[model samples]
Target chain A: MKILLLAAPCLLALAVPLYNSDSPRLFGFPFFYWALIGLVPVSALFIYAVFKMDGGK
Target chain B: MIAHLNWTATLVFVAFFALVTGLGFIAGRWRAGDLDDLAEWGLGGRRFGAWVSWFLIGGDLYTAYTVIAVPAVVYAVGAYGMFAIPYTILIYPLLYLTFPRLWAVTRAKGYITAADYVDGRYGNRWLALAVALTGILATMPYIALQLVGMEKVISALGFEGGPWASHLPLTIAFIILAIYTYQSGLRAPAMIAFVKDIMIYIFVIAAVIVVPLKLGGYGAVFDAAGAALAKKAALSGKPAGLTLLPAQIMPFITLAIGSAMALFMYPHSMTGILAANSGTAIRKNAYMLPAYSLVLGFIAIMGYMALAAGIEVKNPQDVVPQLFLKMFPSWFAGFAFAGIAIGALVPAAVMSIGAANTFTRNVWKPFVDPGIGSKEEADLAKLMSLIVKVGALIVILVMPTTFALDLQLLGGVWMIQVFPAVVFGLFTRWFSGWALLAGWAIGMVVGTGLAAGPLAWTPVHAVFGLGFSAYNGLIAFVLNVAVAGALSALLPNTAPDATRAADYEDEALA
Candidate 1:
């Protein structure tokens, strides 16, 4: 389950074809740009969760 | 260029440079370990806690080159360049999974380098030599490129001199770096990274927030950048825009995944990982180090902001410096340049030390002189560190910068060839040393031949004349795995394994 959580972000971010569009802008950032940038923090949160599940060891 | 020198900025840059130099020297006594010991000098005595390891590894990996080059690529090529964003984000979870085991095993065996572990794991001195040589060879150009990054700032500062005298400031900065790294070892960079990172965060954050405001908003910036890029693509008959073209999707994904996998295999990165006191420290930093990636994301967008602000430069590499110059006040520009320049020092010192540790532990002690004692080994590492820095200095000063850039391209290709031997070996001893060495040879030959000869230094190559393309390193790395796996199946496992599975278990967890 923790592995799934960690792998989710990696898979989502690498599937570039899925988010390769420029529309649906947020704060002036294209969906393509903002989605990848947003993934940085989201990926961090997931990894942090996995770390916590590992007892933070 | 000469007339552009601002006294306010130069003074601030010099002041910050001096402050870091002083910090570099003073770091020798931090945590108060014996300077004569190899572990103390090379790996910070394996004593760095979670926070220090976070800063050190972050500073070491996301270097001055990344600061300058990522935005430069984005400025030149549009959305294709932000591959660095995903590449970086991919590595932390990778770290959470793979590197703690590496740390556990290396610490258990008192190994200072990946090559050292390779030697013990495969019991093949020849194979280990290949690993060490690849590291040193790849690192030589990398260290040179760090100077190239620093030179951009130094030249931007417009210190007055003829061609010969222009290098004076860079030379002096490096001399101080070499001396302190010799005296203090990894501790110098570990301590100074705090300053480097804080300065970077301040300048980059300010740029993202303030640059967009000055040029209307993020909307205006993206719109302007998109229009400009579309115009260029039409004029030049090239595929570049705010979004990736269908043909570009494969290259972008391959580049991101290929680079993320190869990043930790570098000797300098290994130095950072091995220096941590515990596996938990490494895993903890894995989740947090994405903060650097966040900063990198901001840095990549500065390219569009530069376009929107109407900053012009002949070299795209100069875009970031020119962007800061046009948008920020003179003093703040100086602070940013200082941040960028000192950014070079931390990595240069760490790279030289990593290459030196490889030479001393894997090459010199084993092959050159087996009788060398621990004290002598540490001394040799210190001296080799200076030599490596001087070699890099010569490469940057004497040769054309393009040569260093070319070799660095080949360096990445060369570096990933060692991955199967080191990382694969970390999990199982199923592969024999000879098979891995054979794979290494093929990968090196094919990767270098494609990069230097046929592909002419482009990272992507078409496979089998298909319409598809992929990163050359990834292509070569796939070939490497197939050969190694096949040969391992054929060859008997005669190479004696020096480590048991228990050695890779986290000591605290066990």
Candidate 2:
């Protein structure tokens, strides 16, 4: 279970076909650009969760 | 180039340089501690809180070259340059999993360098020496790149003169840096990091907002970059644009992952993590450090803005500096140049200290003289720090910028091979010390060979004739892990393990 949670972000990021396009612009950013930038915060939250859960150990 | 020099900007840069030099001198008294002890001098008494750690690590990681290079790559290549973004983002998760445990173990044992941990875990002096040597070798070029970053800023300000006049300013800047780092040690970089971070935020925030607004909007900037790439592609008769191509997908993923794994492996990064007050401080900063990555994402787009603004330079690394000079007022451009110049100094100081510590602790003490005391070690490290800075200056002045960049690229490939011994050793010690040594040897040879390309002599190109060419570091790392696993299973445990399992697991309890 711990391994699964850690692996999720790597999987989401490496799944290039999911976010490899020029459409779906956000605030003038392309889909490809915005999606990757969006993942920065999401990955940070996942890391926070990992840290919190480990502290409970 | 001479026409581009703005006296107002040069004055602003000089003023900031003087202010930082003053801070560097006074940092000796900040957070007063025993200067004689290696820990106090090398790691700033290992007492950095989360706030200080945040800026220190941020300034150390997001360097001056990064400020210049990331945007320059984006301007040259398109989405391919955004590899730095995912690499930076994913590094936090990697650090979250690895560094707290590393910090805990190192703190428990009073270890100053990663090689010290390797020696403690494996009970093999030779293995520790390998790690120490790799850290020092890799750090030299990394420092040289920082010099390259400063040289770009200096030259972009149109300070053309004879070769001696061209290099004189950098020489004086580095001399001041070496003296303060010698006197104040880690406190110097940590204290000055506050000023560096504030200036970077100001420059990046202003550039992102003001530059895009000056040239209509973000949409127009992107369109201009796209048009420029399309024209280049048409001329070259190849597919290229503002988005990633299918063939580029694999290289992009591999480069990003390889870089993330290698980031914390550098000695300076470990110095930053170990200097923190506790395991919790390290973890907290990992969560917050991605904020700098977000800033980097904005800075990368400024390369596109450079295209829209029609800035051109013979060297791509000068694109961002040239853009600032052309787009902003004289005073503000000077402020931007000062920010970049200071950015270079912070990392150079940290890298030199990190390399110096490895040399004094892992190499000199064990190999040369086991009777060395803490005071002697600190003094030796200070001397070595000056030597490392001088070495970096020579690398930049003697070599071309592209050659220095290739050396940094190869440094990553070489440094990552130590991971199985350092990071993985923190967990189970299933692999024997001899097996780990063998793995490192194989990784270094093959990684360097492939990164050196087909010539077996050239170290410039890293891509080889795989079905598709990829980052040589990742490919070599896979081979390293495989060889170690195989050797561990086949070979007997020839050497005794020096550390117990509880030593690693107990860190969680703290």
- Model 2 compared with the native: what TM-score? 0.96
lDDT of 2 by residue, B356-417 (tens): 99999999999999999888989999999999999999988777777778888889988889
Top-TM-score candidate index = 1
For model 1, how does the per-residue alpha-carbon lDDT over B1-510 read when each residue is reduced to its tens digit?
357578899999999999999999999999989989999999999999999999999899999998999998888879999999889888988888888999998988998999999999999998999999999999999999999889888888876677678888899999999999999999999999999999999999899889988898998899999998898899989887899999999999988988887888889999998999999999889888999998999899999888887878888888888899899999999999999998999999999999999999999988989999889999999999999999999988899888999898888888889999998888778898999999999999989877765535788888887789988888899998899999999996697888889989996655
Task: Count clashing residue pairs per candidate.
Answer: 0, 0
Index of the highest-lDDT prediction: 1
Worst 10 residues of 2 chain B by lDDT: B455-464
Give lDDT: candidate 2, residue A37.
82
List residue ranges in candidate 1 displaced over 4 A.
B1-4, B453-455
CA lDDT of each candidate?
0.91, 0.86
